[model samples]
Target: MSVLVYTESEQNKFKKAAFEVASYAKAVASQLGTTVTAVVINAEDTSELGNYGVDKVLKVSNSALDNFSAKTYASVLTEAAQSENAQVVILSSSADSKYLAPLLAIGLNAGYASNVVAAPLSTSPFKVKRSAFTNKAFEVTEIQSETKIIGVSNNSF
Candidate 1:
């Protein structure tokens, strides 16, 4: 299964976390023996999403997502991931992602990691490291389900 990294933009420019998410996804994809695909909504240019080392870009032209709302944004991105057959979804563990992370996991029926760091530890069993104790320590957690959703720290990659 492939990776789907969610990136956000502001005024046509890629958000700083966008590149950060891509970086993490690239590593996860490599460890999983699959490629990473990036998804951006209301982005000015889909080509720019490719700069992050993902295999392809999925740009959703949505005006509603131009303004941030966790539910709305998650809905759009969740659809994109499904269309791409994403087995693993990655995002920065920001406020928005915290809300979107759980929602998307429910929508996709994917296992969730809400505050994550590092790459997937095992491919067949699917384990990822995440921050515990308010980002103080790291824990290697297993998704335990078919699909995995991870919310990573912005610069952890």
Candidate 2:
């Protein structure tokens, strides 16, 4: 019942959008009565993730991870999520998430909400509310998978 948040930090602080993902994960974990953990590939101030209210952090450090590449990064995240047995995968709708989220979703066959803003009310049905077509509207969808991937809008809780 844990939620795994995928985030990256730049310039020794968390990226602007990653905070919202953390906030979202913190709240979702609170409501679900579970722990929230974050995965970082190459970040400057990874300890800042703790301030976001997550319980634990999984850092996948590698010199090769210095640059951004969707395919490679998503591959790392996929394994991390499986190792953690995360019920929900949380992401921010930044450029990175836009590129990597779907690959993670497709790789795991986990349901994805690319412009998500919230977590599910219950895990039994795995439903969530997400915006679509340029943040114009929202719809509650039932994710058809044992695992769920949520991509929250940038700078929005």
Candidate 3:
């Protein structure tokens, strides 16, 4: 299975968190012995994602998605993940992503891990390091599910 990442954008331009999530996804993909596939909605210059180790890009150019709707975005990501047969989905810890993550997780029936500071400690058990208790402490969380959704903290990679 491939690792899927959501690359966030604004005004048709990719945000810094997009590349950061891509980098983190690439690391996870490497550890899992797979490739990274990124889903970009209404974004431009998708080729730049290749520099961040994205193997393939699924570009969604729809004006209907210009406005941020958590439901719609989650639907699109869910389809992308399923089509790619992705077991691992990566998202950046942005405001919009925070809203989208839970919806995506439920749609995929995946275990959600937020505020992840680093890549998985082990892929077999799907262990990851995440900030806990408002970042005052850190914890290693194990996702016990067939699918896993990770929300990487901003600039953590």
Candidate 4:
């Protein structure tokens, strides 16, 4: 299975967060011995994702998805993850991604973690270290689910 990164874009252009998530996912993929696949919606160009070590890009440009809907976007990401056999799903901690992360986790029945500051401590049990209480403290979460979802905090990398 590969690592899937949900890339957020607007006006047919990718945001900086997209690249960050892609780069993060690439590092995680390297640790997991898998490739990175980026899932983008309505992006005009996905070639730039390769610069972040994204091995593949899944671009969904459906007109119905032109507008942002958390539920709809989560569903699309879930489907893309399943199709890609994604063992790990990474997203930036943007407002939109925060809304989508939990929905996508529920859809995929995967364990979810937010504000992750670094790579996973372990992948077998899917242990991750994340910031808690607004970065005042830290928490190590162990995810037993087969798939794992991570939301990277803004500018935390």
Residue 46 CA displacement from its true place in model 4, Å: 1.1
What is the Å distance of residue 123 in model 3 from its true position?
0.4
What's the lDDT for residue 90 in model 2? Answer: 92
Q: Global lDDT of each model?
A: 0.82, 0.81, 0.96, 0.91
Candidate 1 lDDT, 4-80, residue by residue in tens = 99987788788888888988888888887789888877777767556777888877786767778878877887888
Supply candidate 2's per-residue lDDT for 73. Answer: 87
When summed lDDT is taken over every stretch of 10 residues in candidate 1, the lowest stretch is 43-52
- Residue pairs in clash, model 1: none
Best by TM-score: 3
Question: For residues 19-137, could you state the per-residue lDDT of candidate 3 as single tens digits?
Answer: 99999999999999999999999987899999999999999999999999999999999999999999999999999999999999999999999999998999988999999998999
Candidate 4 lDDT by residue in tens digits, 21-117: 9999988999899999999899888999999999988889888988899999999999999999997999999999999999999999998999998
The TM-score values for the models, in the order shown, are 0.92, 0.90, 0.98, 0.96
Candidate 3 Cα RMSD (Å): 0.6
Candidate 1, which segments miss by more than 4 Å at Cα?
none
For candidate 2, lDDT tens digit of each residue in 1-157? 5799987676445777777888899988887789998997766557777888778888777887788889998999899889999878998888877899889998778878777666565656767777776778888888878888888877668
TM-score of 4: 0.96
- Measured with C-alpha atoms, the lDDT of residue 75 in candidate 4 is 93
Q: By the TM-score metric, which is better: model 1 or model 2?
A: 1
